[model samples]
Target: MSSVAARLAAWWHSGSRWPAVLLDAALIAVAGADLWFNRMPGNWWDDAVLVAGVLALAARRRFPLAVFIATLPMPLLMGQSAASLIALFTVACSTRNRWLLSACALVYAALTIAPWWGGSDILSESAWPVWGVYSLAPAGAAVLLGQLVQTKAELSRRLEEISEVREHEQALATQKVLAQERAHLAREMHDVVSHQVSLIAVRAGALQVSTEEAASKEAADTIRTLAARTLDELRYMVSVLRAGGGAGNGLAPQPTLDQLGELVDNAGMGAELEKGPLPELSPPVQRAIYRTVQEALTNARKHAPGAAVGVQLTQDDGAVLAEVVNTAPKRPAVPLPSAKHGLIGLKQRAELLGGAFEAGPTNTGGWRVALRVPLKSMS
Candidate 1:
């Protein structure tokens, strides 16, 4: 029973033809009943006219004016009918022409009242106001009801359109935010993670080719295995980010100052670290310093192989300063593929933490990369 009610409600709300057809059926039944009870005795023609008016309502929605004209004969003979009233109401619901509506109401009223006006002393038998109410009341009510339904339907349609537009705009805003996050992640994975992994691969290749000691060769194999595993994990992470799906898997731990000593030691090149007592800093500041050092070490390896690189860290006046300086290579450097965005990425990262990054060639044909981070943001 509930399901049947739901379907009926849906049919009523939607633009289904069933509701209109049912309405016409009901009006026809009412008109037929009235004719059956009040038919003129021995008047076959009058009965036929009433039946024709009742049948005409089936086409009322498509041809409201024509159906009303067909039903007008019933009002002239019987003084009133459900068929004529239904036809007039349909016309009002389907159109908005004021002149046309006024004319239809006037004609229907005159026809409905014509039967009463035919007898002698009719004016004396019925008061003018009584006939006026009888003629106009039902017609006026039908027209008003039809106009209200039409207006309500129009308002409903507009609300649906507005709702759809808002949903579309929300989807666009969500996509825009996701796109920005994906771009930032792409830069981090490429600039920092990939660079470190490539260094591991390079060092492993060098050790495998140059070393003949069994244990050293095994260590090189272990490093390559570890590098490959790290790459596989990163590949999965990158795919998840691109597809915009995945539970947030906490990424591998971010780099920090504690890792700097190990980083410098395993750089596969000669480098020195000089620093005083390190100040406690926010995670972002620590990570920035670590990446700056990492990127500088990578550049020294690529452009100045066999060069001695120096890294110094100092804190003064509520700011941490980090600098990497390398001497001219003693031997020709190995060629490496470069995207050239390393310095630019470091600059962007520092600025995000209210810091600055600098990199340039030195006067002695060496290179220097430096970073300065203000501690005001952490405070």
Candidate 2:
């Protein structure tokens, strides 16, 4: 019952005034016929006054203040009819213009009192007290109605703002859910692809070492190298998914400190390296350090071909640090193949492991990649 009533109230408030206009027109027609045909006590001027007041209501919403002002002459010209009082009340209830409502009230009040000084039909000798009562009543009613309109308008605006905020929040929540799903799908793909490639690489390497025929041995070596490269790509994909979800336990066999030398040599860059003992580290921290170096070397080769590159690793009291710095390319080269994703992925990996990653150009005109990972205490 409460919901039904609320809906009805909303419909009433938002509904156009055209239907109300038609009803007012019907009333004016009846009032005119009575005054003209039945020789009613009121003059035709009073009938004309009623018609004007009824027509003013149609424009109440569009120009509410003007509607109030248009009805001002009704009380003075026709000497205060009941219909005139209702029109004034309608204007106040429909409009939030307080100044216009207040002005209308003052003018109507003065006109009501005017009949007391002059001979007007509105105030009879026997009903002088009734005149003041009718005049003051609708004036007070108009003020209350205007306040109600103002309050309703403010409530409508607040509800609209709240609806917009709720819609925005819902959109953000949906995007987060979709991102998590994509990351989960990516994690599954990584496991299947990397495990298969690693197995193939291990088998190919064993075959190359065991083969007696030179031709067969060379073919096996080629297969092994291809498998290893494919495994590296799979590792990168897994790292991206893990970084996406803020979940680092996505896979096993992630390249670690042990693989740093192989990573540089395998890239065929003939890079020089310096090393330090690797402290035992968390799986995620080890992976982050590996990926940072791998991406640095890959970028160096692709952007600065034939330039000398250097990698340094150090383990101190609290952290494991790695830096890969490459010499600047002598010629203008095609800019590095930028996924624009690798560096961002690198940053996520470091942050997820409670470390920091920094990459940019060095002052001497070369690119540098540096990162620090927290180490498990040896003790």
Candidate 3:
């Protein structure tokens, strides 16, 4: 029973022409039979006029103005019809043509009153003023209704166009935001993997130069072990960076506050640590702190070798503050060897998690990086 009901509902909703055409044929047959039986004092042309005009209405959605034109000639040939008035309304509502609509209105007025005023039909006996009033009044009403429907359809079409434009604009904005996000994620991944590779290269080079047999063997074994670990770390970083779709590496443990000292030691930049009993922080905040320290130390070693770097972290009221400062190089300053993207990437990461970052040389003769992140961002 439910299946039958569903099928019936689907049939009713479907816009099939066969049903409407069959209905139009039935209506034409009944109207024809009625005209045949009631042989009024009208001309034989009335039968052809009535059926032909209304049957044209069945194709109104496809040729709306043509249906109105078909009906217009009938009114002139066989007098006024209520069905013809309805067809004029369909034309005005469906077709986007103003000149054709105005032409239709003028034709409707002329056709409605012409037979009564001059033709030798039964309507001619009716008083001229009364017959004109009766026929022209309905035609005028149909024209007014047509004008109103035209205005409504025009407004609806304009609204639909505006909605489509708004959707297109919103899609463009979303794509721009997505592109920026992907670029930022790419930079972050590059910074992390590059920092790790730099450490591996330096350590591996040191081990190759050592002379003591036992110590050299131990260092070589450590380098091999570190290389394997670095590969695993790279896979884990890629998985996190890709989120859902890329390499299916398993989840890795995130570095936290306890790992900060180890990260600075690994950089081999000879950093000096100073802290004032920091308060608890979110995991992402701890990671940011680690990344900032790691990058700053790497820059010092790369550009200002043998420079003493100072790393500091502290809690002041509600904010967690971090700073990494290094003595300026003995040589004159040169532009950092990068795509000018490190500071930009760092700023974006800081801002994304509701933090502030400042990186540049101080007037007092040293480079400094300072960051302040709010605890509430994690919450």
Q: Pick by lDDT: which candidate is best?
A: 1
Q: Write the per-residue lDDT of candidate 2 for residues 236-299, one digit (tens) a residue.
A: 7766664543223344455767787788888666697799777567656766777788778867
Candidate 2: give the clashing pairs.
none
lDDT of 3 by residue, 205-308 (tens): 67766656887867776786777677667767654554321112214565677888887776655687887887677766777777677667766665565467
Name the lDDT value of residue 260 in candidate 2.
77
Mark the regions of model 3 whose C-alpha exceeds 4 Å error after superposition.
1-40, 118-137, 147-175, 221-379
- Candidate 1 local lDDT, 62-140, one digit each (tens): 8989999999988887877778888889898888888888888889999887877856645765677788888899899
Over 4 Å off in model 2, which ranges? 1-47, 79-97, 118-133, 180-379
Full-model lDDT, candidate 3: 0.67
lDDT of 2: 0.68
Tell me each candidate's TM-score.
0.51, 0.43, 0.46
Off by over 4 Å in 1: 1-22, 37-43, 116-130, 158-184, 205-218, 221-240, 243-379
* Candidate 1, residue 187: how far the Cα is off, in Å: 3.6
Candidate 2 TM-score over all chains jointly: 0.43
Candidate 2 residue-wise lDDT at 104? 72
Clashes of 3: 0
Assess each prediction's global lDDT (C-alpha) against the native: 0.80, 0.68, 0.67
Worst 10 residues of 2 by lDDT: 243-252
Listing every candidate in turn, what is its Cα RMSD in Å to the true structure after a full C-alpha superposition?
A: 25.9, 21.7, 23.9
